[model samples]
Target: MTENWLNQIKELKQAVTHSGKFHADDVFSTALLRYINPDIHVERVNEVPEEFDGLAFDIGRGEFDHHQEEKVYRESKTPYAAFGLLWRVLGAELIGEEEAEKFDHRFVEPLDYNDNFGDDYVIARIISNFNPTWDSNENSTDAFWKAVDWAEMILRAEFEQIFSRIRAKEEVLEAAEKAEDQIMILERSMPWKKHVKDLDLLYVIFPSNRGGYCAQAVPMEDGYQELKMPFLKEWCGKSGEELQELSGIPTLNFVHSSGFLSAAGTLEDALEACKRSKELGTLNEGKQPVLLNVSHGISSEWSKEQIKAAHAYGEIIDFMLPKIEGDISQESVENFIDDTVAKILATKASVVYCDGETYLTYGIVRKLKKKRVTVLGACHNLNHEFVEFVELK
Candidate 1:
């Protein structure tokens, strides 16, 4: 490695040394590992660095309530994870036992057929070559990644604590009270970047109770493809294969029969639906971005007073993108989505609403007008609310 690479590795080592404590803020190490192996399975083990695979099988300890032990363990058996553990071991070997132990508690008790080992034992086993049976299975990548993520969480917690201390000191220190005043000054003025890379883990780790699932297909190669179904085959298409083959092509029955989009549920469900749709590669692949279609949620049964109340909220005056946090009202979600449609269309987007008014949200109209994304108001119609979708040449 070059000087810069060596420096980075050194820093990485320092970060990993303080990886034991469970903290929510230390996302950097996890981010680095993800950066290193974007979509692979690898647990961040801090042991030998060269000889053995760190992950040993442990079916006896059973499952834990918070952690998805079984699922994670399954991932730990993948080939990618094995390779990652080996990589760590190789690196550890080069650094030697004494130096490696200084950074982490992985020097002794490398690997065994037990789960009672501490975190250090886990790391050591990862980098040592103690067993061939352990290497027989090929699923270490997931566990390795989990380790990386865990370490990062610890690091972030430590950093936050440090920041809290600095802030506490600054209260009475003023400008010249301390020798490191200049450093403090720089720290205070520095542009801080938000670390939200692990937002996915947030959703995954703490999933909401309420959710709805659907699947659709997008054109790839010659035909179509589908993935991720949460509904029974009866409610969906003819069979799993048929559902998987469902497409969002112009001719197909694109309308969703179920009222998942407008149903009473947690925001978690809504977000999950959108994300699942994106993952399935059915729509919104940076090209032909389709409006997530939903119509059933628009209830005529709602009293006029309720509807008016939802409309009168100041923050939601014209059209607003509802922030997905806290107690989100149903009206807020509906209007926000409607507004998003108008906004996109106002920018020249060709939006096609499934069965709801596409112009009710003025914010959407404004944004759409600016972007020039063509808008298509396909399904339902509402009174009075209008956003200019076309501009005459």
Candidate 2:
């Protein structure tokens, strides 16, 4: 029986190798499936892109009529509403607690929508809430729920195949326990957290599409360039700039370059741009601080110049939260700013850029003011030359 199980494991591993979306447990599930059905076919699961449109959102509307008799209508705005619903459903499935101070990384609640995102910032909120965009127009709300139900049917069948002929519930519980143990060991060994502490300064570059790409596929420049914005030129370029002039300084230690050059690229390419930004930073000799960036909404090819400069710097990426959002208030943005400030404090990051006002929320500005973190807000209103520098009070 052990030999048969080993053989099944081998087959499952092969299936996972071929299946792009297969996670570690998927391998175990595959092995179990093989045991249940000798002729089971291992097919790769299709994963929808995290950034997609067409999500159906339902916005409750009230009865109002002027020219005609008032009649109640179901105002369907599923795209927006979907974020809340998806978070409720999918957020519940994440694995919580691993190696922690409590017990082998205490299992936090599952990475639900709220856990992954917050109302403080809209972009993070949107991404955390919505992963798979639903085709709301094609299917009614009831139909979508029905589809979910049908999907679960396939899931159960797959689960049965993966579990094999397990006669007792206790055995299933044991398997779960063993899996949890392995996860704890892996979480503690993550290198990013350790290095953040060791490094003295971190440079984060947010790539913008200003001159990088035309749509999502076209390019403006051949490669990235050094920080040449009027603000960077004034701050990083100045020899005897005042603390007031340096007010535009997002950081005394770090530099930044972000804005979409173009929009014509794969999500993978966008993610890779973040990786490249870190690499570029490493070229500079020093503490080798971390450099981070996000991908989405690029404008031109020349923008690659910034991404290339970031690559030369050898940047380190910690979090890859999606740029998601909803109609959020200044208070919420401020709270997010405070939370991010806490994270920066924990890492002991001294000089940090708040990016710019384009992506900067009023909440973030207020948080910086309270914490005394130096940040610069690029004022496009002033020929892109003037930067509103915020000093911590």
Candidate 3:
């Protein structure tokens, strides 16, 4: 029985539409038929003439219509409207059985529901709105054809997106396989969570579309609201100079207030942040308050007098500074600050005072903030810079 129906669709070269008010069912069925065979001609008519040699739908006289006494329903009990009936057979042939099933669930099912139930659904309303208004002088046939055009475009785009995601799953799985104990680094981002949700990882770092990289915490389970590991609460809802000050990583971009995700100016910085977060979680395992500290520095840009003023505040922690050369990438600067801050935190000092170039000082301050450490900048050269000992919290 199914083979006969399939053969009929395969042999079909044209679509015959019933004359009357066009619902989403017949319009979409015609659209699907047209998609299957773009060369298929569509003709509108009040009756199926004996000479007409094409599929007749929604006219109470064919296998595709539901107005007959014997109504069609799927195994799950969803009634088969004209669109659903055609899609069940043709969708598999057009795309493939797997994709056709997916399309049925994601696209066709909703449409069938709206057509069989009522016009409450958005898709049904959109198709209905394409009809000529009560006061309008437009032809219904033209409107029906226009609606078919719209439906075809929508179906094509939706199927393309679905197939793209389907193809991305393998890449996501490969990255998940390469993950370390608690963190996975994807060279490029794709839809990954669904592939990696069952993996034993807490964080995933990947290149963002906006350039640079992002570190995001994975959810604890399939639908859990909580993360396996979240960004430090203190970094939440911070950005720009303030966030830089708090994080001490100069290239640090933003941490969402909910602490689920954060952005960094470099992939290295993003990975470092994820590693530091893991370490922070380990340190916090005992429920002890982490004793965070800061260190200060003087750039060659500072004068001797300014250096002396900076030294008066506190002892400077010795750390290697990144070379400030022409056209250095922000990522390189951030990496240097990230390393410096890690070194400072190792000392267990709570605060540091330093004077340096505006950019370097801000970078150090931001990195320190990531570890919840405080900083004080002194005697900086920039106008209205950290003049006196000011705390960067």
Best by lDDT: 3
Deviating ranges (above 4 Å) for candidate 1? 4-138, 175-393
Q: What digit string (tens of lDDT, one per residue) describes model 1 on residues 1-393?
A: 323332343334222211222211112223433443354333333332344322221111212111124332222232112222222343344344443333222211122112222333443343332222344653444344455555545534544554554454444244223312111111132111112121111111111233322222212111111112222223232323333344322211222332111121333343333344344422323233333222434324332233234222111112223336677777886677666665534543233222333334334434543443332332111122332222211
For model 3, what is the alpha-carbon lDDT of residue 110? 69
lDDT (Cα, tens digit) per residue for candidate 3, span 53-161 = 6777777467777777788876556677888877776777666788888678657766777777683778888898999999999999989999999988987788788
Cα miss at 164, model 1 (Å)?
Answer: 2.7
Lowest summed lDDT over 10 consecutive residues: which window, candidate 2?
A: 181-190
Candidate with better lDDT, 1 vs 2 = 1
| Residue 19 CA displacement from its true place in model 3, Å | 2.2
What are the per-residue Cα lDDT tens digits for candidate 2 across 1-393?
Answer: 223333343343222112222111223233334443445444432432234221111111211111123322112211212222322222222211211111111111111122222223332333223222454343232332333334345545643543342222334233324432111111111112222222222221222344221111111111212211112222222322352234322212222212222121233333333333333423323343343321234223443344334333344333222354889887866566567656655654333334433354445546644553433332221123332322222
In every candidate, how many clashes are there? 59, 91, 12
User: Of 2 and 3, which scores higher on lDDT?
Assistant: 3
Clash count (model 2, backbone only): 91
Clashes of 1: 59
* C-alpha lDDT values of all predictions: 0.30, 0.30, 0.71
